[model samples]
Target: MDNFWFNQSDYEYEVVEPCTYQNNHSVELLVGQYVHSIICILGFVGNSLVIVTYAFYKRTKSMTDVYLLNVAIADLLFVVSLPIIVYNKLSSWSMGPVACKLLHGSYSVNLYSGMLLLACISTDRYIAIVQARRSFRLRSLPRSRLICAIVWTFAFLLSVPTFYFYNWYEPLHTQDVYMYDGHEKNLTTPQFVCEFRFTNNSTAWTTKVAVPSTQLAVGFFLPLLIMTVCYTAIIVKLLSVRNFQRHKAVRVVMAVVVVFVACHLPYNIVLFYDTVIMFQHQMCEASDALQVAKTVTQTIAYLHCCLNPVLYAFVGVKFRNHFRSIIQDLWCLGKRYIAPRRFSRVASEVFVSTRRSVDGSSDNGSSLTM
Candidate 1:
């Protein structure tokens, strides 16, 4: 392994170090990669299942359903970018400039989109529960469509900076000139680094303190506050009402809130730590410690993309039913030729009967049944 690359500002070049891992770094990196792989695979499968089910079984024309669909779509798009992250971990970026920008920018899209959808879901439930009758007239299909458009637009705009930051640069060894591209120029060393130079005269306070603090306030902290207040009000109103369970609307809201908290809260806490670290000049005494922290923070953040799908499918009874139906249909397709017609008929009958029993006699009962 080569020595560490030193940043030289005199010459616009950087020293490139050969990629090799020490034992400690190797273990930490391996663990992170393993977790990343699990998240990518499971997130993809789960989100894909939700998308298929939402498209086929629960084709209801409701605003809440539309928001759920958006959630699934965002997760799918985010997880698709995981392969690029995996490659970045195992080796130096082999993909060209365009690919790097697109791939890295996707991480922001998933984060913002998922959070926006959560906010939408919370607002939806708040309206549906707090002013049940009034909300029916207020939250219409067109409004939902408009909100979704705004959400996507906002996400795309926020992610533009990510693409802007991506660049390929070589390292500089001495404060001297060198050949770069096709011309003789003042260049750094040949070691390439993917850098995002946020500010020309930015301090640790700005990068670590200001940016992340704002993100925490707007992204995680504010959303959490709104969700808590809305859900609290909802729960109180639900308790006061005699037939809240009969409507099952309250139950659905509870499930959504619970899952959102479970899947996302940990990552936000990790982000808080990262924000603090971002501002600090020295992360730790040892290089290994810094690397370990990076691995952990990245892993926690990345896991959110995977968790969104699983939570949606498991939290809502309707989502689970829709998912099961798709799975059954896929399974039957493979075995239809070999299986007897009598067996298939019996299975179908049993499934319908069991579903009716579980779903209850009425939609109201079915809402909270699962």
Candidate 2:
């Protein structure tokens, strides 16, 4: 029997000659089709709103703004790939090998990039708050943009293995057996699956262990370590402060760290376990359980993209005010185009008043600023 391990971003792994257990295909379908669809929708909307708000309403005045914009772009690209991935899961890979490599590689790239960007954000915060005197010169906008470029380049390098190894291949599976004329014959079916396909057995170790270890280290563990250290120091600094907003700042930092861990930890744990099991023989039951866990946890990790805007952008008072202003402007424009001529005047007056209120406000308690 051959057992299959399915990872949404890492692709699938096939283990041959495993003890047979009933594999539930419905779980994959349910999560990939429905749960992933919901995530895709929410992620698209949330990331898009962040991008639009940043592009139109807010200027990239600080390093945090630049990092947030890049994070939104990375997440947006990740969510955009979901529909294609869902289609591939529901049916077969009709999009061909080029599309296969590009889609999977891009997914891996964005996954790594998003996590790395979060780490960058955490480090920036630590510098801004914990090392305030040096932050002025260190956190310049040009330097931040350069750092973002370096991050993207490094993420692409991390994803090179996926691009090289992933391809659409048809694997033969034993469907059934029939006895005819005292002879037993096996029936086999070919199913096209998008997965990492090595050229030979010599590359198995590299693909199975090294590649995944790199992903786990750079994509999850590295970010987690950076965030943990940076946020810890930041909280300590906040505790020593006399500012009233210190408590609020501490809560926001805790929320960011908690959400990051809650979203990615389960999936990374399962991934690490799966990576380890690749080297050893495992029972079919264990592999089956791992598959189900991976499917569910991977989707949970994807939910982070949807919450990024809420946690990083909308949490800031300035961003919320800007977003509100955008909405008001849209509403006034709609009224001018669609409402009665008498109502247009009222809409214009309302829009002007709202703009004045937003522009005149002195509320500078932005979560990122702290």
Candidate 3:
């Protein structure tokens, strides 16, 4: 590893070329921020609602529904960390040391959990539908619960090393400088940096990179391949049997695959990039291009937190109906509150009373009685 001087303290500061004072704002950043915030809120709310509504409102205890519940739970847990990314975008990691580790750990855990749960979903659907003759007693609630427990536990276990390694560092890099007094002085300042540092030992490599890479292979890619094969077989079977149930079932399974690919791809890409690609480049000098790449990739990764809810809309008819009802109810509530009959009646009664009194007629409000 190349030795580079960096501020090891909690806070560092540096003086850079000051920008000319201007009130003009950046539209791109603003738009990105808005999109990120909205997605975070939607993911949080949508996933949570899925869990709550399914758990309470719906009573059928199918293995498929249980896995869907697990997915929602995983997604919600993942989205819980998005606010930190949102804040990281707006500023830097103002969150203290504890929060930094927990957020990163939770994020990683849920990322793994989501993929595992999706795999479970795909596998369960395939078994229930394709291998219908087999005793799918494994798909019972107890078995489903056990699988969910194992999936979550494994996700947490996989994320443990990340939790241990990641930390909040205040980085200060040397910069060439010129002072106002015609003298040059290199200045140091605190930049809230989020990075992982493991002891320079052999175990660090295996623990950090090799193990995680293996987990990615086992947890993500293997299941994805299995799903592809299962879906292919299922599709061939469904095509042979021309019936509505087979078509609907195939649609549901396909929707799961599409959702899994769309939402989880960015997160897996981020993991691959950070663990494999960036490992070699971490020691390289930080250039604007590298910084931009990191920012864009991270943004894409965080965008996954929002995609699950959109997937729910596409895949789950129940979710679409639920969402539509929620929107309609909210709209009705807004109209009822904003233009209530009580306020309008009060104003009209006041005007009618005033008019009747001004006419010097009967003080009783006869004309406006109702």
Best by TM-score: 2
Residue runs of model 2 more than 4 Å from their true location after superposition: 1-24, 174-190, 340-370
lDDT values, one for every candidate: 0.65, 0.84, 0.63
Model 2 C-alpha lDDT per residue in residues 171-218, reported as the tens digit of each score: 544346689999976665545778888878879677778777988899
In candidate 3, the residue pairs with backbone N, CA or C atoms under 3 Å apart (3 or more residues apart, or in different chains) clash, namely 12-189, 12-190, 13-188, 13-189, 13-190, 14-189
Order of quality (lDDT): 2, 1, 3
The CA-based lDDT of model 1 is what? 0.65
Q: Write the candidate numbers in order of decreasing TM-score.
A: 2, 1, 3
- Winning candidate number (lDDT): 2
The ten-residue window of minimal lDDT in model 1 covers 361-370
Model 1's TM-score against the true structure: 0.74
Model 1, range 1-370, lDDT digits (tens) per residue?
A: 8889766776686666543336436755676577767887888888887777666555535677678779878888877887676666455566766777778777677777778887777777678768788886877778988999998888778776666865655434323676779777764433444545454555434444654565567667767787888878777877787784534656665766776666566666766766655535652334445556556665665666666665544566656666676666656554554686746776666556654543442333111223
